[model samples]
Target chain A: MLYIICMVAGLLLSRALRLERIARPIGWAQTAVTLILIACMGYRLGSRPDFIHELSSMGLMSLLYCIVPSVFSIALVYVVTRFLLKEKKNGRNRDSW
Target chain B: MVILALIALLIGTLAGMLAPHSGMLAVLTNATDIYLVVLMALVGITIGFNEGIVDKLKRHTLHIIVVPTCIIVATILGGVVCSFISGYPMNISTAIAAGLGWYSLSGVTMTNLVGAQIGTITFMSSLMREIFSFMTIPFISRYMNYSSAIAPAAATSEDTTLGMMIKYTDAEHVVVSLLNGTIISAAVPFLIPLCLAVF
Candidate 1:
């Protein structure tokens, strides 16, 4: 995929280049770009003629779908990491683990 | 950052409502893919800049696989439960859950497989998943474990939400998050369709 390629390319480029000085700027740029994309997403959603109707009609169902799966994911991951991975509650073994 | 994101969303929505066909809106919407690509590259560079990232990734190669696998199974189980509770049919519910927070792809795919209503639901649900992950990552990382924090992020953990991972968790978990995201992202397309057809 293009996304994967771009990521790998960037990674290789960064590794080859001396970019320590610009790291903060790179982070800022990433955040700004992310904000723009988020705004664009909002624009796309809001520009729909039926935005309000769609939200009102499907919002609850959508929320349900989001919450249930995410909760399950969190719970399961917690169990696995705590029991199987033997990770601590506060994640003190961050790097050592 | 979260506050800024919310403000951007609100402002963008207002602008869209006021000038739905504005040239700026058109440009921003059309160039979304470009923005996304740049974001991905930036994220990659961030990771690459970390001198020890590769070593960390290698250290946890086996453990990395476990996170995504658990997420996938938990998500599907959640879908089954959702189907029973929402009465939306097992296939549709499961398909939506299989999205794994990749909104645009899953939303469009579900739309094509089913219809606009289901598509819209998929879009909103997955979008909510991303937003919720943004809000909850801090708490999850603090109270729960670093790995569990990645669960709410799913596929987006690689790029869109990698910043959160970087901010809240450590380098080791960030490496795991990236791998978890890649695995989940690869699975979403196949999983959604498979859920639709099989369940």
Candidate 2:
């Protein structure tokens, strides 16, 4: 709920103000923030005891757990959007909305 | 962007391993929640800057839901297959899949509820999902429809993977990615427990 509210507030605010001039800056900030978050995630994971040991031991199992679900998700989403939503097979859909 | 993210992750991991007790590392790690919230708002602002996105949003109100639903169902089905192949209990397999790329929460939750081994699997698998999404979003955007790019991302699409969505896809798909992530993220906690109990 908080996330939704913040996003809606941002959307409304940006729509009201002419924010185009700062788009580049915003993109750069996004990149910085994203890297920071990823770094933090890495820290959390790496700081855990036996992190490497666990990864080496359960690597195959974990990989299976990750790969199968992602594959299924990608396949299903593609099929549905392709056939059900009837989206074009173009390379990208910048104006898809 | 992807290369930079990988480098950031590597540096952070090395820092963490070397100085696990560093006050600075702890503060930055703990502040991630705040950072995520800000990122979401920024995502909204980015979308808003795209002309006519709101109107486009309205036109596809009903259709926008298709992405997340497919992801949830497919993930569960994949879990079922993993159960057969890996010989783990269906309940545990599905519960792990229910993490939906939110590794931290799922890891802690499973650690508390289940045993450490299962928890580790949950954490590692979900973490891999996130890392894989980071790598695959570009290819998915190129080979499939823009909306399909959000599939691999699952719950991370809202914040962590939004960068990929913004760069590889367009504003409209970013909206879908955000909505899909929020819905799945909301479902993850309940879904994990529900799968454990019911299946």
Candidate 3:
């Protein structure tokens, strides 16, 4: 997949070159690209012919599918991480995980 | 960025609703894929470059790795249970959950193995999973631990859904998401076929 390749390329780039001076710049570029990608995603969804048809129907079901499991999993992770793991070195404490 | 994405989706939906017809959705889809791939690379570079990431991983390995493992199991269970109650056969329901929110691949796989009707449902379900991530990341970040926010997107927590993760969480979570996605994505191939085999 192009997805894996691109990420591997990035890792390769990081290794083969210093890029030390431009690390921050590269970060900025990543931010910009991410913004553009999100917008483009919106564009594709908007362009779909069946967006509304599906939305009122399967969309709602899909939402239920996503919500229930996500809620259950998050709760599970919260309990496991908060109670099971020892506290971190940073003293941010219970406020942030 | 969540607001930005929301606005963009709104504008895009309006555009999609208004347009007479367009032949370019396919092209845009490919472009988005390429663009996202690039973003993934950039994210990888950041991770590859960050020496501290390993240390962070050592500290948070349990959190980073185990969270997704738990989520994968929970999601599959939810899918199997819901589909069974709704009348689908056991294998089909399990296969659908095995999708892990990578809708297109899962949908097509189901279509090839099952049929259009269930395939479409699986596709819609997975697609909604991704869409739901966009809508929920901001809220998830607010209400839950940043990493727990990765749950809904599931496999896409590493890919297309990643921008929202970066927006709501941080680059650090972004890296963790890549790991999370990799693990879930790897599970998909084995899980889908294994479920389908039961059919």
Which structure among the candidates has the greatest lDDT? 1
If ranked by lDDT, best first, what sequence of candidates would result?
A: 1, 2, 3
lDDT of each: 0.81, 0.78, 0.65
Pairs clashing in candidate 2? none
Worst 10 residues of 1 chain A by lDDT: A88-97
Using DockQ as the measure, the top candidate is 1
- Indicate the TM-score of model 3: 0.59
Of the true interface contacts, the fraction found in model 1 is: 0.69
Per-residue lDDT of model 1, residues A1-97, tens digit only? 5666877777788888966569999989988886776666667667878877776768899999899999999999999888877888667754446
**Candidate 2: residue B193 lDDT (0-100):** 83
TM-score (0 to 1) of chain B for each candidate = 0.74, 0.72, 0.69
User: Residue by residue across B1-199, what tens digits does model 3's lDDT show?
Assistant: 3454446545655655665265675455346545656666776676566556567677557667777878877876776676755567778777877777876456545654675445556665776677777887787677656666788888888768888887787666677777788667656756777877864
Q: Give the TM-score of candidate 2.
A: 0.65
Judged by TM-score, which candidate is best? 1
Clashing pairs in 3: none
CA error at residue B147 for candidate 3, angstroms: 1.7
Please give, for residues B1-199, the per-residue lDDT of candidate 2 as tens digits: 5467658767877887899999977987778658766765775677677676566557667546778889999999999999998899999999988899977557655655675567657867988899999999888888887877899899899878998899988766777777778678767767888899999
How does each model score on TM-score?
Answer: 0.68, 0.65, 0.59
lDDT of 2 at B54: 60
RMSD of each: 5.1, 6.1, 7.1
What does the lDDT read for residue B164 in candidate 3? Answer: 83
Ranking by TM-score: 1, 2, 3
- For residues B146-175, write the lDDT of model 1, one tens digit per residue: 899999999889878999999999887888
